[model samples]
Target: MIEALAGPQAGGVDDLTASDLLALARDRKAAEDRAAADLLVVAARWADLHPPESIHDAAAFAVPGCEHEEPIAGQGAPLVAEFCLAELGAVLGVSTTAAKKLVGHALELRHRLPRLWGQVQAGRVPAWRARSVAEVTIHTSPTLTVEAAAFVDAQVAAVAGRVGPAQLDRLVAETIKRFHLADVDPTQDPEDGYLHVDPRHATIHSDDVHYAGTMRLEAELDIADALDLDRALAHGAETLKALGSDASLGVRRSAALGDLARTQTALDLHTQGATGIRDADGLPAAREVVLHAHFDATLDGLTTVFGPTGRMEEGQRLVLLDQLRSWCGDSRTRVTIKPVIDLNADLSTPAYEVPDRIREQVILRDRTCVFPWCTRPARGCDIDHVDEYDHHADAEGRPQPGPTRTSNLAALCRFHHRLKTHTAWRYQMTEPGTFEWTSPHGHHYRRDRHGTTAVDQAEPPCPPDIPRPRRP
Candidate 1:
């Protein structure tokens, strides 16, 4: 076979047949690949158990052994790709995200059809097909057993041919729900060993600046479940008052305790007003001031940011707000200075839609989707003006086109953001309804009235140093 398919580059066969040599090489490579993939699969399972920080640290250690100090030059995507393409997993392995899918399927199957797992491992059915049955069974009925597993598998296979392991697993779970029955309750008296607690929390923001402070209230135990909620609230209020100091009550507590206090405070206010209010401050006046700040800052900040107007300044304000919230505890009393980006509408340019009439007209022209492959109606798109009506790019590439116009805007959903930014897919609207796309391999694919056409051949092989598509 090797001799028959040998190219001019192939050397003349020696004593051994060329086919034998080729076969040997193929087997060796396959074995190596499988070994590598297996190791990666095991590694992925181990990594799931450990912290990502530890995995990162191990990656840092491996870097010293490489010719270059970095395995993937500190890049995340490439590193992930490398791991995925490891010998065993390159053809059969999955990404971390994909692996998580398997884990999720396993958990679903376990919860729905405990007996079906053994059926799957025994090869009676594939993993995904089994999962699907499990999903159907659980949804239809509840208790699953080995007897029901066979029926579930056959029913799922008939509906959906040979499902992937993950899908099969889900099907099995669903099927179990549909056919399995729960066990009957025992005739003997049942013991109640578990405790149920429902906690509530509330923060009182003093309306008056002088008296306002952040006072958290919480109930320690569930009064409804215990039939003593009022007692619990009273006890919590007393504890809070006792804990409060003149300057401020300093409650050095764990996050759990803080949460409990806040919840109890809410219950106190709801059941019996003012029962859970805690003033950590030594003076009630300071507590009032804190409460005032909280109300003014939280409520005022929300109004100032959202109530104002259109999308023009909303994005800018939101960005600044995000940064402010991160750095400052609250937006009260803190002064914020933001460098202005040009958002003024330009009247002269064709792309500029001052009154948004031009915008609607543009949208009408492109009636459907802006993306080359997408045909979704344009009604939901954000009218991004094309011309630099709002943004003025400086010489340093600061100001540029704002997202409006027939030519500049392509209707995109939130999911397509990264698809446009990172993927090989590229699109351009040449005319009102016409579009073009260039694939990652440089294939110019165009769709028109006649049909789709591939205008080019395969792209040249990329160098090792040059990154390739993460996946086909």
Candidate 2:
């Protein structure tokens, strides 16, 4: 069946029987598992080649404070050179962050979870399944001891590494408890056991807004608070119904939350007015939201038969114009319409510090980090000078090599910014909103408004200082 599906003369996929198709799919999946296993082997070898001892002298590339040891790895995992991740990521067409995780998982499995790793090598378990187990063990709270990780490996190997996420989590928890891996506090609350971890959190899923201009909210509040909020929502929903709102109960309840926010803003404003408190502008404080909505010029001038779709810069989601109008029309919401700046025009500052106008231009231009495969929003990122800014250019009376300008600035998340600053990775703004990046391994990639693309595959120059591991 493998020969029929994957060997020479395998082009007749349309003529294949249903059973043949199923067999082909299974064969392809098996091939993928083998490839994944091979990737792990390569990642492990890469880690071995760039061990801590190899890059000890290269202090600039080493992760700060982890010169002798890699802090990202598990207890029993091998230490890898901190700067090695970017080159590997470039070669493998993945993000440096992803490559680091891959190396961490490989080391965790090969050393900390030997049985599972062996099973992966023997093809009895898929590499992904084993890696999943390694991920859990490596990141357990308080950190897993060598013995605890070994216990997890034994349990997983017994099941041929066919553990689901929930089952794997439970296994890690059990192993931690069995080995007493977590630190125990003698004076802590006995009812909470040795673990004093608090799981309560209220999270607003702002990054995952939907196309309908809605966001998901989750919370784990105290029982009394939860009940009180529920009662308030119910009361607000009833009030809306009384005010002739024909929306469904669920929709009204959702709207009630917004009402609650507006109500709180109003109460605060009322108190400020009663107290005769005002800002420099002589106005009471109000809830304000800045929303950037982009509309195409050719789209009927922001009106259509239904309504033009707009892109919200905050969440990078498509939102209806109607929804935006509804939000702006809220009684307590203050909307400030700033004058539109021409994105094509370049803005510059004489000093090294970037002006707010230039920063906003950079954010609006690049929507996210300019690094390859980095999705961190530009608004939260640092506006990095594509060319290194010279602090003493004016003092020295020399030409400013790197001026603070819109064309020279690009947004980079903190980690990638550090990586660009310290590592061999280098990038330049080839054009406005377009950056060309060259990794340590001589691989070139381009990132622009559209996304990242591999631009060059030049032969990597050897770093004479870094030693290569001997192959067996």
Candidate 3:
């Protein structure tokens, strides 16, 4: 294989034999797998930088500007992992779910299975095979875990690249048995265990012109419980067939299952003033998402960002609003009408405090920290004043306060908040929806509700480095 990798650049491929082609394909895949391993390691390392600062338990203090550096390892690790998942999804053009799986691989590779990580890095093991082994081995660790590693390493050294994913899994399972962890204890009481239903996989299969979404579910249940669910679905399917539904058997069965599931829980839904307002767990439940529709009839322009996804098509926004309004009375859903923003919304009285409603509007508009590339959800941020508040000098030489309104308010996560407060990152709101920030080097940037789109448009989060922005 090494010879095949060298053979391509060392000679011409035009004269290669069939065996040579096979070797080249295998070698190329090995190289690519190693590159993937390298990328995962780097991402894991980058996530380590902003170690989560623990706000609870025993506390330690860091000076205002350096709070990010003093957190213990694993402090704030979840947030960093979340950030990695979001940005990695964007970069890979994959969904957040897939990105999270990638992060799982990254963290496990870097921390739990360094020896296997090194094997992948050296191109001695296929990436999928290594990951399969890691997943099976992850929880089998104790002081006994070190022995498991050496045993697995010896097996791999004997037959490394020849193993497939299934073979690797079997090897790991067999090795784990030496430590008595290959199978569950049959003597344990079944009633003590809890059932779980999980979405095991959701995959997208597509060509340039067509696509399909496929999902598989994983569930654990007792034999009697499984038989009861099967009987219920069978009865529902028979009833649907008797009703003369035209769907195929498979489609009819699926519909029957959905109907049965909905019927089982549909009684819990309530109107705004309904007597019962609890979920299955008996907790109060109310719809919290507010859909915003921004339309200007005079200009014939309209748009709305929907669903917490922060992704909305401006062209269809008004149409979606109309459809939603039409469905309000016809469906079980409850809808409310509320104004999310105000034009002359200056709050001059409190001078620095933002009311809850206005803060909510700002958060919805921003969706995240106004700083570039920072995906910290705005709900947890400090609503910073774009223009710092201070006592104003009036025409009569009397003191006046600055206005605290939506125009001057923007969300900044804790780290960026301190950076802005203590550093030379000067900002001003030149217009209602735009923030103009100037670096110490006199570079200029514009941050609107949308994002960075002009000169000195901020660098990636954490660095606060000034990047020369380009105009669109």
Clashing residue pairs in all predictions, respectively, total: 87, 0, 2
Residues 1-472, candidate 2: write the lDDT tens digits. Answer: 4455654466677777899778888888888999999999999999989887776345444345332445556986777777778678877777778899999998899998999999999999999888888887877786888988889889999999988865776676666667877766667655444233334568999877765667999997878989999998999999999999999999999999877765555475575566554445555545555677876656555444457777778767777778767877765566676767688889998988888988888888999988987878899999998888888888999999899988889999987886787656789988889999987677889999888898976756668566433111
lDDT of 3: 0.54
By descending lDDT, how would the candidates be arranged?
2, 3, 1
Name the better of 2 and 3 by lDDT: 2
Q: Which candidate is the best by TM-score?
A: 2
Residue pairs with colliding backbones in model 2 are: none
Tens digits of per-residue lDDT, candidate 3, 1-472, equal 3354455466567677898788877777777887777777765665564345422111444434532432111111234423334334434444444555665665555454566667777777777766665554443332225566556656765666356555565566556556564444567554322111121232322112111111234464567877897787788888888998777777676666656544455344542334655556543444443444443434344343531112222211223444444346433345565554554465434545788887877776666665544556677889887766765445557653445777778888876676566445567777765667654334456667666644643353433344323111
TM-score ranking of the models = 2, 3, 1
Tens digits of per-residue lDDT, candidate 1, 334-410, equal: 34443322222222343344335544444444443444333344445555332224444544565455544445654
Candidate with more favorable, higher TM-score: 1 or 3: 3
What is residue 273's positional error in candidate 2, in angstroms? Answer: 13
Listing every candidate in turn, what is its Cα RMSD in Å to the true structure after a full C-alpha superposition?
Answer: 22.3, 5.6, 10.0
Question: Model 2, stretches more than 4 Å misplaced?
Answer: 1-11, 56-70, 182-209, 216-232, 257-291, 296-306, 392-397, 466-472
